[model samples]
Target: MRTTTRMLALFAVPALTVTGCGLFTDETTEKMTDVANSFADALNADDPAAAGAVTTDPPRAADTIGTLYEGLGKDAHFEVTGVDKDAGTFTLDATWKFGKDGHNEWKYTTTGKVDDTGDGWKVGWDAATVAPGLDAGPLTYSAVYPEASRVLASDGELMTQQVVTVVNVSPGADLAAVANLIGPISPGITAPSLQSDLTAVQGKPITAITLRETDIAPIETQLAALANVTLSPQTRLLTVEKELASPTLAGLAQLWQSDADAAAGWAVRAQTAQGTQRLAGRDPEPTTDIRTTLDLGWQRAAESALAPITQPATIVAIAPSTGNVVAMAQNSAADTQGPIALTGLYPPGSTFKTVTVSAALQAGTVTPDSIVACPGSANIEGRVIPNDNNFELGNVPLHTAFARSCNTTMGRLAVDLPPEALTDAAAQLGLGIDYVTPGLTTVTGSVPAADTPALRVEEGIGQGKVTASPFGMAMVAASLAHGSAPNPTLVAGQPGTPDRTPPALPATIADQVKTMMRETITDGTATQIRDIPGLLGKTGTAEFIDDTHAHGWFVGISGDLAFAVFVHDANSSGPAVEAAGRMLRAR
Candidate 1:
């Protein structure tokens, strides 16, 4: 009986020992799993320092984890999975997003080991645990661009090309000499700025402005001869013709920047001693040509017509049927005023008589042939209004009065309508509304309330609180030709659709106004330009002040083309009329 009892006790000892070993193993695994889960929480929250606290090498772990985050373009996160505490190991899954959009995520798995510290469990730090193969080295981001696309005209003629010429100045170079050499080639190159750039480089060469290929040609020889200057050429987008430097083309050039940048591909890579490995992103898609509605021939002709005019002048030509702006040109004198053709705010002068006639006819105040009195001058609301040069043809038909630009007669006619009549008519003719089109900017003109007889008299003659851009006047002529206002467009695919639909001009009113404009060209204010076949126009000498010089203006329509020309500070409308004749003849 004593021997059997001793055997039972021996068996009980082995069972107790086995149970103790199992409990120790289970407790160790739970502690290791807790550490692994805490580290992963820190990494997921983008707190590498916190993650490092649970690692054997805290500082090294933090640095490695931080580098992995940055090397992945700062778009990375991790998860802890498949924890095996008995083996002191855990599987780490890392995700990296490198594209502009966060949709592209490169995911891979790595292994992290846990160790039993004196008091608690801690992770064994390794760069590979942050990202697979990151233990080798760091990563970098770069952009590789394809050949830029060219801008083309309606007839497939090349309008612009991408050209880059780097103007490099050596350290301590003579900036004044540099400016003198390059200033004539390009404006806005200042000596002080050039010197500042050179000084910032600290003996290294500094790149000056990147110019167009054609622009660089004239100064290439001079630049090469400079002792401390170097000219390096790279392809960049630019206008082909210097004359196309007008704002219309400049706007088009500005729009091409996005497409060019998109064609340049982006990549994040890891460059190690062994080789470079592409980590994320892809090459840019192939490019496509951008087509515009500009007619090069008409653009050149308009430029030629405005070339001879020394004063500030602008001309805009559009196809009345399609509302396609084919030509726009501004002389250097006008360019100083800044895109005046599309944005200049000036009184339409007698050109706005077109609106008056439309308003009168729409309101049933008069027909094209209704007889109206045209006196030398008339008093209305204590103000005197007269025709151009104060000469009047007395007692004429409404068409004759309009063609002659009889200010007093038109003033009388406008007084019969409500204050909103002229403004409402202007809106129907596509004025007073902004066009929200890509790459095209405009300041559509305005018409203020004519609450008093004095204001009405002035507004009738296009004098007081009424204004129109060259673009707006062209739309007026286009409205007459189209029997309604047509939405003008610059780009082929992106037509400028108005936010609110404009009311259509009545067909009868448009017809009568067209007749008045035709008669004006044939025998009235614009008779000087009547030689051009189908020419219909209105001449304007808008008085800016009581004693100062007036602005010259003309809005004309010939065949498919409708145009507006402006000459600032002209003593008479003759200059604008002559410009119109030259442009129409060229057309």
Candidate 2:
């Protein structure tokens, strides 16, 4: 869901909930950083032994980071970033500066130790990323059926989501032959020996590399050196970096130097913190930013902590001032072309009232205190649109009706307004159109394509053939919050400059809507949002064709970030409110 707002839409099957937070921390913050730096120094110094010397106890002998230094020396440089040091461990934040634009920068984190060995300070690579506890069994690629998945990232994290290369090893190539075959592929591993360090598959020693689970790709020729290496199949562990020494490692590196898979693997993992977990075999991860504007600590923590209680709710967060997507995650099991953000056409529910208000204001139809009757449901041009907030509540001010999400009020406002006014306002906001710019795409979330009174009434209430993407909703929030139309943007590197979006409505109208949205939490359906300190928000209860309990929705802005969320196909609006509260409560 963190891929794109729609990509993680959780429409039919609800709740792939995620959490948010600051940075990250652990036991070994600084020492890990030191070992990573020391390893970089040794690699620059062309001293594999010196690099191996700094490894901690459960040493990482043959993992990802370990192989980074296997064969090559003085070929790659390092760029260090923010580092955090904990109790006995440390995290080295750096990027592998290899080649000239051949690769931008491979980010990675190396975890190391400085446990008081009673000998000053000792540091080295952790064993998790390395998987040094090998069976001495040779590692090999399954050439008979070599397959790889590629992972692509729009955020430039260097991950792949496509196949790059394939290897067809001999039926039973020995470790030496395997090593020799891949010697020219990368600069990480060494050729195999005639001796017995490699494993045999069908008397062939075949193994496989899979980056499917994490959006990375796997290739045979790219991993020719590691083609036949096989640790116990039961072991489910992976690390962010390596601190190992092996001829096989050299072979993998050799392949990595030229071949795509090995090189990309090293590249993506290079800048991440060391992590170990079970990885499954499948198509490579989709090419998208794994390193979101999202705080890594929040993402990892959400996956770790929320896996227990939260289902899958599509979460889209952005920096309102700059429109940078901090995080996007969709927890649905799969895409069903259901009510996905950009595609599906569903009722926008009361959320669209802001648009209705805009239309009315633009047409000089209503002001904030314009008195409107709330008869629960109003028949606008022979079509009935009823209020879910059925408290009769006589006639009320325009702003009050919006904060309360009164369907009747908006429906009447829509019926009376010129259709062109409403449609124009929607178009100005970027709807009923293709929004394929660079970072985000607009899927015509059912903007009023034509002019029918029923449709118009529904449009006013965010219902009927009216739908929208979270990104679109967030834009509305940002527009209202800033009193200016701001295009949503992903934080690729930094906001060098931004394209200007003309105001979607008159400046005063946007300001008035902003007030109503703020009043929503203060005196409306979204009272739950008031729990947070400074908040402005709107809650929605969309009515689709097939289900009950209107799909809950809420969009809010705080600090410098603007976020929009939908607890699609849920049991009640409570979850959506909770999601909004989750964002609001965060300082």
Candidate 3:
């Protein structure tokens, strides 16, 4: 009887144990799921402290957790895969997304343990599980960039090389003392502003400015002694003539980055003393130099011509045959107003007579030999038009009128064409056309279509609704020189596009316009450059706000180069023509 009862008890025990296993499994699964969810919430929130709460060593876990997210600038989370109650462990997959677009991601499997510490079940966290294959050590992030390359000119001259210096300022013990120390080195340094900027943040340093190594060498030791100043010297590609080519050089750098993006010239990596891992992408290949269409000699000539100007001035040169930008220079005085040479909109004055003359010849309204009356001034439809200083040449040949930049004659010629003819002609010359390219910022001059006779008269003389930049006027000369509208290019492979293609002017018309321009040098307003051979040009004194202040302009072609010189508030065209002469002679 006792044996049978013992056997029956054993059978009953097996059934009870099987039933208990289901209950325990359900409870363990729920608890482990909750732990995984809590862990993911902390990581996604970038709350390192909260994430560390579930780990064995809170401080160590907190540091590693913070390092992983902060260094990479990423949002991380995890999804539970399975839980093994018998082994007291759980499996999960961690995911991290980086960058503004969130297109980059890192996903990996990791394991955590369920530990009981008096109150309830807890997760055992490890840094290695946060980022797959991470070892026990400090994690550091770095972006490795390839060595900066050179920028070369079309003629194979080096335009830029790798070298630069960075300057910084910080809050120090004595603001006035530091300012006094730096005042002689940086003439513009002010105590109040320096103090304010340095104290803007409690413990942060500020970058005051960047200068060439040669510029700062004289005061390098003195600056180093200052508690508030810091100097960091770096080697990066910079233009040889920093001021002359700064704007274009910056644009070229951007263009190079775009090309380098595909080749992976940069990498964001996570590294430890033990090993390094590429977090985002592979490293780049060795860098190569970039070639541009700039002519270094021409650029220097333009720079020298504008450097001594006390007032705002600009000079631009282009290769007429290829439409390549050979040189662009703006004096420091003009730089205060921004890149006005390329982007400033101003009346073209008589320099625009090129457009008017082109239209008149194209429409057969006038010939170079045709007789035109150039009075001192004339009233047309209630609007008055006059030559410079009201000068007059009565009944001269059209070529003579154009050579002298007779505004009255240009106005009279405008009356003969269709009201929109000047605008169309300017369009044909590449004005009013937007140039879209990488790193090139330009304002395509505007030529408003005239609906009234008075407006047409004003447009003819390059006033009223007609406006242009040195770049635009240079293109006008280039069109005549090249026989077609040249698409100006800076970078070798990147050429700018116009708004639309324009009809080609008749060869005879272009040739006649060129002849008239040559006359300006030999027998007209631009005789200042008459000694310079093979030069064709025009001079302009654009009246601004009642003629007390006038902008001087000169647009011309010398050899294979077409260019424009502009002097703000010059009151006469002599300065611009003189500048052109100096630059052309230098070239």
Candidate 4:
């Protein structure tokens, strides 16, 4: 009887054990799922503390989670894609976005563990839970920039990437020693000025100067030996030729920065104890070069021609066939007054005779061969007009009068025309037209309508209300050469759009004006530069402030090239003509 009773008890023990095991497995599965759901919810909400609350090591987990989230940027998200309750783990889909507009995305799946360690079910804290294969270290998001592009000219690079050495002065350094060592090499940095700048920014290092590699090579060792001086090598965009400096470079740099930014790539990396680990992101795209219409040869020639002139001077050249600005150069004195070659307004003086002749030919008022009177001085409607130095060309053909720049003759013809005649003619020659050009800013010039004969006489001679930039005068020459006003351009593939398209000048009228311009170079005011072959030009000595001071101008066209030369306060047109000759000879 005792053996039979023991056997039954053993059988009952096996049945109870089976049922208890099933119940325990079900409860653990439910608890594990609950913990997984809580952890995913906390991460989705970007609540690091809440996420850590469902983990085993709360403090450590919270700190790491917070750091990783911040590093991934503001738009990181996590979701529990799947859960394996039997294995005590969950699958999480993680996504991070980066970039200025958050257009870049990084998506991946990671596995996180859940376990019951005698207390309760909790998520097991691990770096892998945040990002797959990540080590226990700070995560970082960084921008990977593309290689800087160059500003290209017609023949070669105008601006290129170069390494520059930055000279920095730390606080409490020997200011006088630094100044003495670097002052001569770097302009505008003196001992007193360094002290003032240092004091302004308390406890911060002052950058004494930035120098190109060639500029700093000889002085590098000397600067490095000094106390509190640091030489940091950094890459920068600078002109290929040191002498090639222009305000236009600033605009090109801005455009280069935009291109670099657009091609920039990004990465989410972990700064681990071993090394940097790139988790996600794409590599930067190759940067494309920026093309400009500048011709290196023309630029160099223009610069050299103006270098000797002590006074303010400039030269602007364009291609008649394309209207592309080939060269824009100014001397040091002219630079001080700003980009005057492109925007500063001065009376065109006798250069306006081109417009007058074109207007007369269009109006049938006079043919190129029509005889006209050109006295040294003439009174028309109570206003006195005279030629340069009051030189007379009495009763000559109209073409001869124009070639000689007979101001009285032009004035007489303008006084009989309609008020808007000069204005209309100026537009036809691209003088008064407004253009919206990319990568360049310019003002053509203005020709206000003259209602009275007195004003008309002045307007006809490029005086009174008429004003033109050197750039505008260049366009006038280009118009005569091209038979129509060409739209000006500075950057390749970017042409200026005129505010209003004027009617094209008649081919016959253009030819007539061209003939007169050639005569001006051969037998008229611009004969000083007559040796240049195929040259057609006009010279002017514009009186400003007083008769003793005048701005000299020479606008001309030779083959496909049209240019304007301006010599400020030259007192006569001789300097302008000489400079123009030098520039043309150089070409």
Judged by TM-score, which candidate is best?
Answer: 3
Q: For residues 437-550, what per-residue lDDT tens digits would candidate 4 score against the true structure?
A: 776688989999998888998899888899999999999999989999999988899899999989999999999999999999999888877888989998887888866688
Q: Candidate 2, residues 1-587: lDDT per residue as tens digits?
A: 47676655755234422221112233245445665566557655656467657655423442433454442223455433444453554544444434445333334455444554655345544543222221222111110111322211233332222322323343344545545545444433344432232334334543322332222223233344454443221212122212111111222222222233322322122222344222212222222222224443333322232122254454455565665555554443313333244344445566777778887888887789999888877778787776675666688898888888888888888877776666667655544434433333335455754377777777777877777876567666666665655554433453322233444467787778778888988998788668675677777888776645577677776656566666666545567667656544443
| Candidate with the larger lDDT of 1 and 3 | 1
Candidate with top lDDT is 4
Worst 10 residues of 4 by lDDT: 130-139
State, as a TM-score between 0 and 1, how close model 3 is to the true structure: 0.91
Candidate 2 residue 484 C-alpha distance from true site, Å: 3.2
For candidate 3, write residues 1-587 as lDDT tens digits. Answer: 99999999999999999999988889888887787677777877889889888777778788888776666665666777887878887888876664435544566787878776656766776676676545445444443456656678887655554555576887663557656655765777777867677678765887765667777777678777877677898866566755555346667877766555444433345575657766544465666777888888888888888876778999988899898998888888888898888898889999999999998998887789999999999987778886777899999999999998888899888977897788888878888877875457887699988888888898999888899998888888888898878988987877888778888867888889999999999999988789999899999888788867889999999889999999999888988998888898885
State the weakest 10-residue window (summed lDDT) of model 1: 155-164
Off by over 4 Å in 1: 1-72, 86-89, 94-137, 141-147, 158-161, 168-171, 187-207, 214-235, 250-266, 272-276, 308-312, 332-339, 448-452, 543-549, 569-571
Worst 10 residues of 2 by lDDT: 137-146
lDDT of each: 0.82, 0.52, 0.80, 0.88
lDDT of 2: 0.52
lDDT of 1 by residue, 63-160 (tens): 87787677666667778878886567999887876545765556889899998878578988887777766777776666655666777778665455
Per-model TM-score versus the true fold: 0.81, 0.51, 0.91, 0.78
